[model samples]
Target: MEHAGKHALVTGGGSGIGKGIALALAHAGAEVTITGRRADTLATAAALHPRLNALEMDVTDEASVREGIAAAAALRGPVRICVANAGIAEGGPFAQTTLADWRHMMATNLDGAFLTFQAALATLGDDDAARMIVVSSIAGVRGLKNAIPYTVTKHGVIGLIRGLSEEYMRRPITFNALCPGYVDTAIVRGQLPGLMRRFDVDEQGAIDIIAKGNRHRRLLQVDETTGAAMWLCSDAARSVNGQTIEISGGQV
Candidate 1:
């Protein structure tokens, strides 16, 4: 019960890494509000824990984010832990990427985090201790091949945290990011078919190719990322701000 009585809001908590972290926060005694664009998906995740609640929110839209977070705060309390985890992962060669594709990536990955953090922060009082986290990809720290738009959005969120951390240093809030490499999420699984077709390899071969991107040469589990999130929300990590915790099993 490390997070007893606090309200933690996790965007994209309907599935994958977001769901995992929401459940963990609920287990730690926080009133967890999981938000996403899908009402059914959010309901399914909310049903997993007694402390978990569902909120349908579209992060890409400024109005949706502001209203949804306000509703969440009214239901529970001011958000003490804000996890901006809602994002899409679509990758293609830089030359083939259309302008719409780049715009969509920026809207969802970079702008979504910006809207979420801003809305959540607005709910907190001057003295309330809060933690704002962005779920970035390893591509944020380094370039990713054939994923120009995705890499740029991920890097943009890192810049968001770095800037917010400095600006809010005098306050009781902290801003940080998580950079994980090749986690076994639905997004990663969806890319396998493309990899198989492009490389003319079997499904397993494509999986192996993806896993090779990680330093450990294996796919990371949801719990690995959840554990890091739990630690960052704890009292021990109060001073650990403006940093990106890389969960790639080793150096990127």
Candidate 2:
């Protein structure tokens, strides 16, 4: 129970990698608040674990984020660990991507993290050790072929963490980003059918296409990314800050 009595907040915690990380934190004994836009989903996720609490939050809206975090913190305690995991992964050719699409990605992926980190920091004590983990992607570090919007938003998240890390260099809080490639999540599963339709291939072929995004040509289970998140929130990583821990099979 290393995280006993700690209040951990995870955005987008209804499913996929976010759900995995929330469960990990709860298992480690933290009072977990899982936030998402869907109340039903949040409730369902919360039902799965006694330590998990559900909060309906639209991270894209600054007011919603601020209000949601404040409410959660008031109910549990100061947010000692925050997982900014809410994001959308949409891919299209640059010429086909619209301004609305770009803005949507930026709103949820970039602005959401900024608002979440700021609000969580406000609840943290000056002398307390805290963790802010932004769930970025390998695309954050390097460009992807047709995911321009996702790439840009992820890069922005890395920049957010880097800037915050430097600004709080002397503080007890640590900022970091987790860059995972092709994790086996609902987001990736949603792409399989599209890939099949686009390439006229079978399910395996579509899966292989997504898996090839990683250097090892395999899809990572959500647990793999969760492990990295757990480490970032652990005491062992006290000295690790302003770092992007890449979970791709190999270097991009």
Candidate 3:
């Protein structure tokens, strides 16, 4: 167990990329606390493995994150690894996007990461080794058409990681980001209906349009991203701080 006895916290750990990362860490012998707004989802994920625990938390809410992560640390010990993976992905034309949608995106993707990292760092001291990973997207590094709000929030997260990494340069803590493209997840499935309607095509046709966005013209599995996350947490990657690990089938 490479991570035996380590305490890892994964936000939005109930499903999608978060779930995969949580399971991987648990298998590596970390005491993982998976948090999400859905109690049922958290409970279900916890049921899947003995090392995974459930914590009901909303990243957008400062109080919930502060208290919930504190509680998690109390139960599982100080959080040595924090994965800010909870996010909402919705996209539309910039002019057509409402202010409310923009706020919602920023609240969850940008502000949420801010609060998550802030609270998680509170559980660690200067001498304690830790890793903080922000689950950004390919959009973070490059702009995506018709996804202004989502793109903006993602870019903001990358900025957050870069700044944090510099601030903590002398400390044992490291900050990094993972940017993946077109992962095979519930989030991607949900986009199919919209794509079909917008493109006037069948499901497979819409999927083809989406898959082409990846360099290899195929969907990425959750484990592909999980492996990169696991590497970020390893001692071998100690100097790889403030870097963006892009997994888009090829270089973006």
List candidate 1 segments past 4 Å from native.
none
lDDT measured at residue 151 in model 3 versus the true structure, 0 to 100? 94
Task: Give the per-residue lDDT of model 1 (tens digit) for 1-252.
Answer: 989999999999999999999999999999999999999999999999999999989989999999999989998999999999999988878999999999999999999999999999999999999999999989999999989999999999999999999999999899999999999999899989988999999999999999999999999999999999988998899999999999998998
| Candidate 2 per-residue C-alpha lDDT over 177-233 given as tens digits, one digit per residue, 9 for 90 to 100 | 999999988889899998999999999999999999899999999999999999999
- Stretches off by above 4 angstroms in model 2 are none
TM-score for each of the candidates = 0.98, 0.98, 0.98
* TM-score between candidate 3 and the true structure: 0.98
Pairs that collide in candidate 1 are: none
TM-score-superior candidate, 2 or 3:
2
- Residue 231 in candidate 3 has what lDDT? 97
The local distance difference test score of each candidate is: 0.95, 0.94, 0.94
